[model samples]
Target chain A: MAVIDIRIDLKKGVADPEGNNTKKTLESLGFKGVTDVKAVKVFEISLDMPAGEAKKCGEDMCVKLLANPVIHNFSVTVR
Target chain B: MKPEEIRVCVLRIEGTNCEDEMADAFRMAGAQAEKVHLKQLTGETFPEMKRNLEDYDILALPGGFAAGDYVRAGAIFAARIKSALGRDVKKFVEDGKPVLGVCNGFQVLVELGLLPALDGTMSPVPTAALYTNDSGRFECRPTVVRNDNGGRCIFTSSVERGKLMMIPSAHAEGRLMSRDLDFIRKLEENDQVVFRYVRDDGGKAEYPWNPNGSESDIAGICNPAGNVMGMMPHPERVVTRFTHPDWTRNCPGGEGDGLQIFRSVVDRLG
Candidate 1:
């Protein structure tokens, strides 16, 4: 069996309102060193298959539903 | 079937809260409509609940979160629909049937690749998205939407060209965006733009007036064939004169501004 992890984030040019607001709050709390902040959604799946197959499944899931290509980009890692 | 005989499917899934009102709007427009659950269509639940997509002349997807909008607003619902009734839906559109998606429903349509199926009846993948609002908050407010279909969209048939109609919008993610650079141009060239958010006085829209800050002030759009449409506003919520945000001022008791949207589809069927 293998474990797969997928991370999804907004596309580079897309405006991330939630991430920006979080950055603002952090700055107000005295975290002035934080120059940038971005948010990503992570999904961890335990697949009852080989690592190669698990990786394929994760990519398919991202393309099919986990990540919206219109405004997001995603990466899948299997271990 | 005649207008009165037209059977409209107000399709829904879990977390979809607007089916009843959507069905009511169709009924008031003189069409025989019912709120059909997605599971019923997929035959996943009761055997008696099973329904066929080809059985209806119109399919309307209403608002509210489906599957709690976990990933993206309508991604789960769209995926479910694609796996279960993709072919039937494609055939229904090919047969010239009308499909309307309002608010969250609009998100589902776009995610399902039904609307802006620019190159074909149904794209192999979604070509656009209803992203998070610019305000980063759920905006539930009344807005004026101007009819801009230019006669290409059957859903806006009763609305005069460039006329503004008051409708209410409620959504946290309703900013329609596309990676396709020519998306807006193609929509314009094909006359697929059905509505544009506008100010009450019919001037250029600003922050709240434009609601979610969609590209080109777009609020609603239709497929090239004009049968499929997706809009961020809830026309069904204002199907009566009393439902208008400012009804108390003029107080002319008649059909609501949004009724024309429902009436147009029925008229097309008629």
Candidate 2:
């Protein structure tokens, strides 16, 4: 069995309202150097398959459901 | 077909709270509307409750945070619908049956690749998205949307061009966005743009008027064939004059501005 990890983030230039709000909060807490904050989502999945096949499956999952290609960018890795 | 004979399926799932009002709106429009659960349509419910998507003449997706709006607004529900009933929905649109989506439901249609289907009836991937409001707050207020489709949309055929309708909107994410640089141009060229947020005086909408800061103040759009439409406002909330914000002040009409939308499609089916 292999485990796959998928990470998704908004594409470049897409507005990240939540992330921006979090950054503002951080700045107010004395983290004044914060230039940008991008919120990301990670999903860890356990698959009963070979590592190579699991990686392929993770990519398929991102395209099909985990990530929206319209405004999101995703990467898959086998763990 | 007669108005009473039109079978309108007001689809619902967990966290979808607007189905009742949506079904009621259709009923008021003189059509037979049912609130059908997603499981029923997918045949996962009891035999007595099982439903076939093709049995309905019109499909209406009401507002609310379906599947808790996880991953993104309407992403989870759209994925489930795409996996289970994608072919059926595509066929439904191809048959020229009407599909209506409001607020979160509008987000679902965009995620399901049904709206802004510029190149085809349904895009393989969503060409546009209903993103978070520029204000970053859940905006619940009255909004005016001007009809802009030039009579190409079946849902607004009864509404005259440039007519402004007061429709209440309640949602956090309603801004329509696209990565395609020519998205607005393409929509205009294809006559798919249906509604634009406008001010009370029918002037260009700013912040609270435009509500979500959508590009070109776009409030709703339809598919190339004009059979499918998705909007970010809650038209069902204003089917009667009593539901309007200023009805107590001076109720000018027996029905509300939003009733015409439901009546338009019902009239088309008739």
Clashes of 2: 0
Candidate 1: what is its chain A TM-score? 0.95
TM-score of each: 0.98, 0.97
Query: In candidate 1, what are the lDDT values of residues B112-195, reduced to their tens digit?
Result: 999889899988778999999999899999999999888989899878999889999999998989998988999999999999
lDDT at A70, model 2: 74
Q: What is residue A12's positional error in candidate 1, in angstroms? A: 1.0
lDDT (tens digit, per residue) of candidate 2 on A1-79: 9998899999988888889999999999998689988889999999999999998999988887778787889999898
Instruction: Please give me the DockQ of candidate 2 compared with the native complex.
Output: 0.73
- Worst lDDT run of 10 residues, candidate 2 chain B, spans B246-255
Query: Each model's C-alpha lDDT?
Result: 0.91, 0.92
Q: B35-60, model 2: which lDDT tens digit per residue?
A: 99999999998899999999999999
